[model samples]
Target: MSAPLGVIVAVRGEAEAAVVAEVDAHPRLTVVRRCADLAEAVAVARAGLGAVVVLSAQPHLDADAVAAIRAAGAGIVGVGGGPGSRLEALGIAVARSALAEAVLAAVSGPAPEFVAPPERGTAAMVAVWGSGGAPGRTTVAVNLAAEAALAGHRTILVDLDTYGASVATALGLADEAPGIAAAARAAARGEDAGALLDRHALEVAPRLRVLTGLTRAARWPEVTAPGLERLWPALRAAADVVVLDLAAPADAGASPQGPGPRRDGATLAGLAEADVVIAVGGAEPHQLVRLVHVLLDHDGPTPVVAVNRIRAAVAGPRPEDAIAAALGRHAGVTEVWPLPWDLRACDAAARDGRTLAEAAPRSPLRRAIASMAEVVVAAARAARDAPATVTD
Candidate 1:
């Protein structure tokens, strides 16, 4: 038989005894290490020394600790029991019974299945985002997924914008299927997410699975960061390529300027988890500046920039050249794609609730989108092939 999986438990104060007793009772998990704080626990996990981590509910544990655990590529389970208390949303099973054997059985069970690993050399994320105005993010995402599918890649397009999601509307399937929100809710309740793919997804193109956004803004609370974390790994395993259409946040304030309580929080969480970010901006100077500021606050990977509504005869330099130059100086943006001002094509596509490829395949806009997809696919492949490394 295979050796028992090793697990690390993090506890503080009087909780240490409870966790130690649980670890001792588990037959399938050998407690390799115990830490008094999240940082110490993270250090042990990052060393590739443990298959799982159990973190006690402590006031000191925060989201950063959780991110570190995920970046280290280990499972984390949070424990909690008190008035007005809830377990932190780790993807692993939660143990409230304070029983060591029961908890160990849950944690040591078979790992959840995901979509097959991405193509051997493919990166895993392609994000489509836009500036303040409607820059056709959903349109770009839908057509891009279709293009990827046509190219023979098993593709999935996810709508992650909680407050103003429109993938269903763009596909003309509004309120027709229980899309991303349902999947997220299922994950939040610790249910199997693979079932979500079979039950909730609506097939928009051949071999392309569509994880649509919320049916309404009021449903934003159902989609949390932990729920998304659980869903995305399964999605990546199931599809050859994954495209995410994100809501454009105006700024990194307390919340996004949308019509809901948790809109901004959800958007920020989505950004943090995304592998690639596509920042879509308009031709205007102020709009480009806003995109730059948003990118700075995010302070992660630099995103591919796309300038929308380019009119050569109207005002300034070519939108692509101008935005590239400005972003290079301000946001260090080197990659930029441009979409020409094609109001007729955009309006017609929106009217029919179809993608630009279906409504206006010959439009100059299609070329830009196609080019963006090619670059995105290449980048994703490179990231996937990169070697894994330990982090502090």
Candidate 2:
């Protein structure tokens, strides 16, 4: 005869005894472990000691924990929770009244199928990417999003920087907000991402919404590439223009959690999903070289390169010309946008927790960003008007 399926029961209270008795009596279901709590259940699941986990409704049983358990290759069946409970969102749930029948069916049942939402008028996603030396990536992303919003496009600025997420601080929003992490978790759970964003996204300005990044750098694993893959389509459906403030694209292969999600997963994911990539770089010679390398290595969409803090001290006598010649010679990039260095204006905006347009509307840097925003708006309009290609 075939071996019985391994089951881990984590139900609490008096109901636990009845559930265990029922499972033990089943011929096809074998109780491998009776976990004291969700943590133990998760650990046991991670160890691959159980094929199915029968759990109770616990306050800590969130989507992250559910994802971790599923990632460990275990099926979940909740006992005692009624319809519309948290368990329903996590996975399969059965009533305690039908313990034996429900447990058996849950363990032996075929996997449920997930239907993707029908394609609609998806938004244009723009990724603001830069190299390692802090080339004003966040600054550009924030300002560009603000400009887009000012121009009447519904814009969402997502901070996907796993290394250092400072969009919240820059925009004067609370840093501890759930932001993109919560959205990713919802996406992982197959929840309606647009509805979730409506609840979690912070509206700092008219027509502009902000989804902040990680609360802790160590929590990078929560934002996996696969999770973001599910998230991108939903994000596209949520806004007219999605601005992603991404981390530097340096490959940090497999994190400490083995060959799972890496540190740079967010950056890579954003780049892949972006309709246009705004590659930002400092105007200094060395920074310019790094930008050239970035341009050369990128094989995706044609990037709109913007050189920030352009000055005679860094780019020599004629800053704009020097930048143009260098980029043209090294990276074959002919056209370039130069954002003049206006430290006073930038400092005032940063101090006041406002975008360039709001704090220093007349700043030369603000004008440059506004012009870039116009270009982005035009690109989005063209893309939306283009014919949608069908795939097999």
Candidate 3:
């Protein structure tokens, strides 16, 4: 007779032995190995030693690890409940007697199909990120969203600066208290994020909506993946363009445990889902130096660079040329958008709680920002027209 299907069990304590016994009892399914831990199981699976693996719902078996294990060519099924969707098909109260059937089903059953509707609109995300030292990221984000709206595209601007959010203050919406933190909290509680999202996002200008940031920095923990993940997609569905003002710590890959959430987790999460990333930095020597590093560190799609607040006083007569040369040499940047030093106009808009489109339409700074917004809108539209390359 043919040998039974190979199964590796990675469950904890007595449950591990019980699973092995349960699987071995079946004539079609057999235990090939019983791993001491998740690491051993992953290593073994990576080596092509087994056909199926029953994993623990412990902290070690995360989403990335599961993807890695699957890449190694082993079929993975969850043995218990976990934080992520590692083994979503299996039930929490899965019977030991049914373990063999579940394994067989995972190996032989029809793969779960994920299909997108033909009518779903493609909403593009333009993420505005700047390294440490305020480099007008909020200004760029707000204007870009506003300008896109002026260009007749539905746009949503979000403040994701966990360190300190300036979008609300700059737009004089601090009194309204509309922001993502409360929406995130509501989303985490399993409420309809779409409804909460619309409620939190206020229309600062026609065709332009703004989702303010946290009132207090300490409340950032509420911005969990469950909520932001839901809210962002919903915003995209409602608007043609979504602009996010990101902070310096956009790549805090550190996986923190328990109560103290990673302060910049929301930024990282948002970037992961963004279609375009606009790395903004000042033209000053210090800001440029950090900007080069930040640009090089980004690992997503080719990013657009904006040398914000470029002026002769700080960066010499050819500030734009100098910034471009430095970025090209160090960070291999070929193109850059120069935002002229028009502090007075920007300050006026902030003071008036209005966007440049409304406050200073004739300003050179506004013109440059409008140009950048045009580029963003065109790119986002092009991306939308192209075949959807993303896989869930």
Best by lDDT: 2
Compared with the true structure, the alpha-carbon lDDT of candidate 3 equals 0.76
Evaluated with TM-score, which candidate comes out highest? 2
Q: Note the Cα lDDT for every prediction shown.
A: 0.70, 0.82, 0.76
Residue lDDT tens for model 2, 1-392: 99988889999899899888888898888899998998999999899998888888876675566667777878777788777555665555556475656656655676432334455447888889977699999999999999999999999999999999989988888878999998887666656666778888999999999999998988987787756766676677778999999997674343454534678878988888787888999998789988988898887877889999999998789999999998999899978989899999889889999999889999999999999988976786676567979999
lDDT of 1 by residue, 222-331 (tens): 77665676676677777888888888774546554432225555566656655667777776666777777766766567777777777655426565676667888997
lDDT of 3 by residue, 181-202 (tens): 8777665443555777678888
Q: How accurate is candidate 2 locally (lDDT)?
A: 0.82
- CA deviation > 4 Å runs, candidate 2: 91-121, 172-200, 212-239, 250-274, 292-303, 316-336, 378-392
RMSD of each candidate?
10.0, 4.3, 7.0
- Per-model TM against the reference: 0.68, 0.77, 0.70
Clashes of 1: 7
Clashing pairs in 2: none
* Candidate 1 deviant stretches above 4 angstroms: 1-123, 254-262
